[model samples]
Target: MYKSKIKNQKLKNNTYTIAVIGSHSALDVCRGAKDEGFKTLVIVEEGRDKTYADYFKSRGPSTSSGPTGCVDEVLYVDKFKDVLSVKIQNELKKRNCIFIPHRSFEVYVADYDAIEKDFKIPIFGNKFLLRSEERTEKVNQYDILKKAGIKYPKIFKLPKDIDRLVIVKVPEKARSFERAFFIADSHNSYKHESETLIKEGKITKRDLEICGKARGVWTKYMAQKRVFDTGLLSPTEQAELCQVVKNKVPDLEDLIQEYVDKYLY
Candidate 1:
């Protein structure tokens, strides 16, 4: 069984130790630990792109096989479960190591809780608080926008909403041309050759040709109205943007505040 040490409790040995698992984006953490004179161990998957390894090697740290003139050592663990095994846990315990899982792996509340319970190591960030705070902030921001009467385009989810002159947007995998569409309001509309709209009889071969002629995948079905682009960023723009973002994505601000509170302040 693992024992819990209170916050600020020094390690048995004056030396600090840290094990970072799946550390893709948390390279800074490893670097920081090393700078702090901690015996740092990083475990990454072998099949992954070797950018991380190359980075560490170039920096003259260590290799996965063992220590190589770096701060400590690097280990290439093939599986996630291997890090939690008895052998690995025993080794970590022998060194009184703290385990910090990589943030890019979609960490869950249960994962942090389990690590704290099983390994008796402190994982930065409260799982439940962070998740809840982010969700609440987003919802609140959406509500604020609605209340402030900011006009946004109606979100269409169905193909039937695609009239002769209608815009089609693919939000998830949207790119340059895919980001938005301004369909011309025409009585005789030509349909584009999109698999989604093609099956719905919304587009035809002629439409495909026209769309192909255009720079992007979305083609205007009808002659569009003259729309002025009022794209100026003013003081009001900045304030409104900040308010909207704070209301909708409060968690982002919260995270910044958390970091300041923890490290800076």
Candidate 2:
């Protein structure tokens, strides 16, 4: 049903546009496309168009001097999911747009089947990769990482098997996209924190039990007490680690506190 560049003669004109949902890495995608001298389009929801329509909007296609901003055009829709509508798809095809997927696009669109089979736009990345972002998906990021032989945190099959400090990663009850992370040194602490989080409405008990044999199955990393670029500890572990370094580096705790305040909240 969808006519790609190979099938459409209009797309062979060489005037291609880069298009993306107006969230997550939209600015980065638009900026990169603009750098390469291509027009960039951002599809935004009603209340979320300001960033693309005003802040980073370009003056014109190109000027005597140069382009002003990254976002060349902004198409406002009632919702991000509306981008899958026939009207939007037709408009994108007319522009010869290569749609780029991001975290926000996958989350807001919320329909993997439509993205794969219904929406007819030429996607820049593999649409199947979008499903992998969800932890519930059969073939997820963890599966991909394992297949690639990439070293990640070891998952404990059972809570009792946890011999070292490990972080428990689970989806938040209210927000499935966000993870509720906590660190535990043993089964007792793990159970305690899990109960506490359940009481606090941070996570669902069913998800805690079903996600991995042990709730820590998702992300149970050994706390080697060293900072590495590969893995970052939970906020709780970071605070605890900062306390140990506070005595040696008097200002370290303050800096860590500043970082947590600025970013973690």
Candidate 3:
């Protein structure tokens, strides 16, 4: 129904604006939108509006004076969640804005149901995909990857199955969003690392047991590829992997092109 509304209404002055929350990937999103000739609007928290509304605010279209910053408009809200308010949504609708969700949107809005059902704006990407990041969700990224037949890291069902170099991933004791890892190659090594972490108060014993126990992956293969084990992802390897997937799954290539043609034009 919301999509129908977007399809039926003519944009004001035939102008479309790209809107995004003012954190995480906001600068990148706004910059890309402005480069593509779309007006950019950022919804920022009151204290944080300075970056978008002041520093990167657009001076006007590009000119001989050199390039202006990307952001065109900034809407200040008391809190990020205020963006879901009907008043805010209506204001965005008046400007013919299509929201582009990012990390901040999922982290601050934090409610998948509200984002999918209550927020009545046209979103440029799949909002439902946001919930899949939560491992506690009934169906998550791992499940989706498995169904798509995408090759991901192998999961050990038990600690005893860990026989090669492996990393136990767990959330930091204070910062849940950030991951803390300890490498181990066997049951003894796993126990030793986990105990060290617990003794250092870097992670809770419960979290180490529940989250790290069966999540260890044989990461020597990744190290051999000079990837994740090095604590960095190789862009070259990433591109090659993508190409391999596209060649192996012809339907996925078509699906990606379809999305690009429909949403990106």
Candidate 4:
């Protein structure tokens, strides 16, 4: 119940109130909300940032718990679910706030009924947020991509070409599998390790068989080809990209536009 900003300010029933969780991740929604005359409330667990929260001490002393620019008030909570509880949101008492979550906290966005039931705060989000959060539940994304006519690298065969430095990788869907994290440069190393793990009883024959089947991710995309990727990703660009996508604007599509409109030539 941090009330420094709200102490004297008139709490409006008509003006929209936006509650942001990942201020570093989805700052656009905060700025946009403020621009549209919506009161912004940023919620921080330990006063962290929006994206990864690795080293996000981005806030100044004036706000401390919250960042400036788009934020009106900053609220800190000991627990995540507590903020969603009616007992906690009742601390806001009369102010009407819409909980529009950023992508970093999109998991909570999927819990629409529970959040709405407890906080009675309407989110200005849609089913797309839920879909984004449920990406882990989907293991058939490659099949879906194939259906979309998107091309992928060629699959490998056993006793395949090892001299060419064939790539062995885990499928995107099955990347969570404990043993699938490795990426071997050549077929020989991959085969040797798989067999070694099976022999050591660390992986069973059935597990090996299943892994082999799913190991179609081993592709011949860069077979003997020296590839040079240009402008792949930079820290500043990626950071800007992360900040821009959380709201509805979507990807560098919106950010690039913002840059051109505001700063670029």
Q: Against the true structure, what is each candidate's TM-score?
A: 0.38, 0.73, 0.72, 0.43
Q: RMSD in Å for candidate 2, one decimal?
A: 10.8
Q: Against the true structure, whose TM-score is highest? A: 2
User: How many steric overlaps does candidate 3 have?
Assistant: 0
Q: How many residue pairs clash in each candidate?
A: 5, 0, 0, 2
Off by over 4 Å in 2: 1-14, 60-66, 213-216, 222-265
lDDT of each: 0.45, 0.75, 0.74, 0.51
Q: Pick the lDDT winner.
A: 2
lDDT of 1 at 239: 23
Q: What lDDT tens digits, residue by residue, belong to model 3 across residues 159-216?
A: 7778876656777898766667656679787888788888998988876666633323
TM-score of 4: 0.43
Which segments of model 4 are wrong by more than 4 Å? 1-14, 22-26, 46-68, 91-93, 106-119, 127-132, 138-265
Whose lDDT is higher: candidate 1's or candidate 2's?
A: 2
Which of the two candidates, 1 or 4, achieves a greater lDDT against the reference? 4
Candidate 1, 1-265: lDDT as tens digits: 1334422233432375766764443455565565445666666678752545565642433555444323255566666556655677677777767766543432422253344445444444433333222211334333444678985444333344445444443222222122223243332332332554556544444444443433223322332223322222543354212111112112334545756886897
lDDT of 4 by residue, 159-216 (tens): 3554443444332333223333233446676777566655655556564554456535
Please provide, for model 2 over 1-265, each residue's C-alpha lDDT reduced to its tens digit, 9 standing for 90 to 100: 4456334534442388999999977887887677656788999888889999999998754657565789988888898999989999888988889998878888888889888888788887578788877766777887888899988877777777777767777878999866777766788978997999999999999988876653225355543433322323644365222122212111335446756986899
Q: Lowest-scoring 10 consecutive residues by lDDT in candidate 3?
A: 241-250
